[model samples]
Target: MAITSANQLELLQTAEAVAREKMIDPELVIEAMEESLARAAKSRYGTEMDIRVSIDRKTGRATFTRIRTVVADEELENYQAELTVEQAKQYLSDPKIGDEIRDEVPPVEMGRIAAQSAKQVILQKVREAERDRQYEEFKDRAGTIINGVVKREEYGNVIVDIGRGEGILRRNEKIGRESYRNGDRIRCYIKDVRREARGPQIFLSRTAPEFMAELFKMEVPEIYDGIIEIKAVARDPGSRAKIAVVSYDGSIDPVGACVGMRGSRVQAVVNELQGEKIDIIPWNEDVPTFLVNALQPAEVSKVVLDEEAERIEVVVPDEQLSLAIGRRGQNVRLASQLTGLDIDIMTEEEESARRQKEFEERTQLFMDTLDLDEFFAQLLVAEGFTNLEEVAYVEVDELLVIDGVDEDTAAELQARARDHIDEMNRKALERAKELGVEQSLIDFEGLTPQMIEALAEDGVKTLEDFATCADWELAGGWTTVNGERVKDDGVLEKFDVSLGEAQDMVMTARIQLGWVDPAELESDEEAEDEDAVDTEEAGA
Candidate 1:
């Protein structure tokens, strides 16, 4: 079983032949063998010994040698003893002190153990080299789509042979509701190219957001050229997706380009995605507009923003509510992500009610106080001034500047207008507090403590005030403190208070006084009159 000189030659030739067949460099194979020998020698011999392996490329011969120091003291037995001058001459002619000599030691015959050890080293080195090469080849391919053949399925992940290396297609990365078979040609995006002990760990993904982006880039020339940018994209994978596109040129429409003629361009991408619906929205600098577009196939009437809350209320038609919200709210949800807004979809009915309430409140404020005509009242309402505070805070000079009012009229109206506005505001604050409206709600209009107290005493405390008092009573009554009149009909007339304002004041007053029971007020007035008469007669 010993490897004679002839046997070593045959082994080296066999290794060379295998290297040629495998397209591996022979010198690398020899180096691997030498490294293996060094490892084996180190394992067998202690670190005190210097072991080296040498290989002759031309002859295909290899040798191992152990170098030792000549020491005066023999504490380390591995070090040969210092020889006398005459004894050194026997091995080296004219040897001097500290001189080293090389002696040809007989080659050790390596049996089955050495052969097995060398084979292991060669295989390990070859594998390591192959891994390093594969890592180098694939590292630059990240973020690109590559075609591969499905190799097999393991643990719900498809293994793909990407020519140079194998790539993993995780179950989650595969397009949902789609199937593939072994040997099927498929395209995937290279998510990552990682180095491992075996080889390059190429990760393939079919569900990455970049996959859609890349598809767009391929289908839209403007996108690749950077003329039209895909600002944002969101997807529900196989169901639907939304992409926001912006163009550098103001005249050019990014959405139109992406959609192509008859949607041929987007259709191409859609086909790739297995018939998934794609919505290409024109990106807008204004978030509200962008969000409206993001929620496609549904017309948006308005967008109410709650910036601090990061929420948006979108008003659409009753029929379009379901469409705007989409199945399971997918449309708005995706739109929210695409436009970076938290969207709440509302039907036209809800929106109409809200607008009607707002309009009534605004109209009441204007008609109740301001001397302006209906045209002016409507203008103020349109301008979003629906409360006394807005009018009270408006500068008199500005009011005078408004069309149809001269400086003299402006000054006179300004004083009375301000006083009326202040009185209404004060009454509203008091009414708000009296009606048990939370301090938080009261503060919504920036009402101060004094204003709240005044409004409460005047019975104009909260939104509930109108529910308690009749409109005529509120308009006719005066707000007093300690039997002293603080406000009267003159004050109310000064601002031309409208029916809505009168109603609100009355409701607020009733709520503040806590005297008007909603149940009684809500009951039939005739029945209450009969009951009162019967009680009076009984007492008599």
Candidate 2:
């Protein structure tokens, strides 16, 4: 075989045909051919020589050239491909280092072995070009829905022939008990696209919450038009799901729009999801109100939300408890997911008992801490005095408002409360010092003596140690691990310090230690505020 006139035109034709088959640019295939030819030429014309090849786009003529570079005397390592600057003077009037010299070379004859090697190189290049094309085509299509044909099953995973590429549907990503045979038409969410050593991997999913949102977008015109937006989605996949939607238009009801007339829109999505039951709820800015809507078909008697803890307590009538909790607690679980909160559901009777218990505990705390009689402590608890600190720091008028308490009696009560608190503080300070707490940490201004003792107990004895602590370390929080809520205990959590307060105190300590610049911090906060405002506006 040889690069003669008879086969020169065939090179361009072959490149065009292969490019058309792979849905890639013909120029890429031509470039691959040029390199393969160059490789073959190098094999015939001493492998040490830098040989190059170029094919004319219109004429399809293969041109071969030999190239050598003039380099410094010390850097001329390749005898055939590089020459010293002094040695290059024979070919040019003045040749400088880094100059490339080229001379036309005769194309090499391709023997059986050379032709075989050339063929393998072309095939490898074509395969790589095809992979690059496929990756480029599918990378932008992630987080979308696509239709494909089931190709085969491997180890409980389904492979789909998604036009131009194969997508893998992992066993765990499929709807429960869903099975597919060859050539079955399947619609799936493009969960991810990745370029790997073997090739590009397209991961498909049928259980993603985004799949339901996309289905609703396909079914409802309002959602497609952006008049109605899906604020949140929670799914048990193939069983039950909840979607929260809000409407930008006051005239349009988001839930009604998603549910469609006679449930047609929702029914279509349900059919596609293999009969997954869906609860369409209206979105609300108020988290508790939204949670009440999320746990539908079960009436809520009361809703108590602890914003700092991101926890909510829902009280329902005893008869509705089962309904609110659902079968296997699925209803409350989905509600928690939709609202992004930890939910504690209780019956009205249970809530009453819990409140009574709390009242008794507070009454006891006041009784023991203030040295007051049971009736007096109960009266203080009834007046919203839960702790000695409140009684100690409150105005005299507040204590006087309690029944059977005159000005003198109120004065004596406050005096007793203050003295008890002072004694406790003194004892806590002594204990903290004994535990090796530094004065710098004790004098940090926001922490009480009890808080200082707790910090010392946690090995945070210095101001630097306290500054290095994360906000969550000082404010207890709930974390999700393996799909279950886990509690993280904070040393200062018992002092009722919120996450914001912890952050403020930590930043203050950093500033005091010159670890942080307040002016820079102010600028960063201002920029963050602007970004948040921009994000909210874009989401709107």
Candidate 3:
């Protein structure tokens, strides 16, 4: 069916209606019409042929014209080829070659095909204009909340009708436990505004972390007003969330302000989140304390920092262990993220056991390697040779020079000292691996392989040999060296050793060497009785 002049007017009216509905400027619609007509005319006509379309908004009249170039040669089409000056003179009195001639196509009332073409052009223009309009309207609203009605659902994503246009709430953006029905009222953060073929696309999100932050901004005046700053926020959407807050004004309580008076403020945020729990903890500069607070409902007794390990052991009561660790360790897991600490939770009993084990290990290591009796061990510490390695490695000349030895005593002590050193070195090397002492460290600081071989040439080869030496003998003897009086008391005090232990070891060494009988020492009282009778008879 051919479109008449009335049909063209009706198309113009429809364009105006769409323009009004989409909030697009009417001038843009008119420009689109002119462009579309120009395109259609160019397609129908040849490239070299010039065609133009003009519309009068006031009268709704549309006109089309065909333009041709006049040339001197017979090289053009769409007109009388190339008109000679004499031939052009027929159309115009002074027609010149190379001049353009424009002729109106019979005001062909737009036929049915042309009318349909114009209608499509106008509709496309309106749709594009509306898209641009919606894009402009919503672009500035990113990161803000908008209330919209659910318009429809497609492939599990909801289309929501915001005031100016529709926004998409993708399935992944919906709160985990919340569902929306068509026509349902929902509030979401405007995540993005995209321009598409149909119109502006406003993307709404209910699951973004910023969603919770925005709700708090609305509910907490302090945050909105910029007095309270939200440092960070982490959420397990629709279940629970943690927000770190700090207040600019020291007098204001950031957590309290966020929580509102009587829990009214935070509750509103929670309700918006569909009953998801919110923990409003005060931010602390102290990391240990802050982490303790972040794992809420868990009372921490103490925090042991293992900085090299990048972990902190949090001690809590037996009952609070689960709470501190949370279900499947979520509480501590989030707390680690929030506070940047690798947290390990332990009950008080576990911590105690760990400490006890460490102490026992150190004590056992001390006892096994130093071969000294408890009292002699204390004495070696007093004498500044606190460890077995230190005592065993001392030079005989150095020991002899220690303010207490005579030349004869020094010689006698050297043999015993050599034996002791050899024994200690042998034992140290044997136990090195079990004691966890590195071989390289032992070689570096104490006996090397060469030194051990040299000591083995002498008969001393175990810690027990070193343990038999008398403390007084080790410190030279009872005489002075280098003209200094041998202050036996001073040496004893220095080594923290008692005289009785020293005497016993001296006697034990004699017995071991078989120079004295244990029975003769025990029978000394009877020998004294016989000697007294013989002395009394001689005096008579």
Better of 1 and 3 by lDDT: 1
Indicate the residue-level lDDT of 100 in model 1. Answer: 62
Candidate 2 C-alpha lDDT tens digits along 229-336: 999999999999999999999999888888889999999999999999999999999998999999998999999999878889999999999999999999999999
Ranking by TM-score: 2, 1, 3
How much lDDT does each candidate structure score?
Answer: 0.73, 0.93, 0.69
* Global fold similarity of model 3 (TM-score): 0.59
Instruction: Give the number of the best model, judged by TM-score.
Output: 2
CA shift at 119, candidate 3, in angstroms? 2.0
Return whichever of 2 and 3 wins on TM-score: 2
The lowest-lDDT stretch of 10 consecutive residues in candidate 1 is: 485-494
lDDT of 3 by residue, 1-540 (tens): 322577668647866876787789987888777766765665555445577777777776767777655666566454533455665666677877677566665344445676578668877877777778778878999989999999999998999989878889999998887777888999999998877666677889988878988999999988999999887677777887888899999999999899888999999999999998888878888878787789887899999875533568899999999888877777777677677656778999999998767555544434455343445334334344433344445665654544445556545444444565577657656654444443333343223433333323333233344235455543323454893333443222334334555466546656755667999997996889889999999998
TM-score against truth, every candidate: 0.60, 0.93, 0.59
Model 2 residue 365 CA deviation (Å) reads: 2.5
* Model 3 clashes, total count: 6
Stretches off by above 4 angstroms in model 2 are: 72-74, 84-94, 459-465, 510-540
Top candidate by lDDT:
2
Query: Poorest 10 consecutive residues of model 2 by lDDT?
Result: 363-372
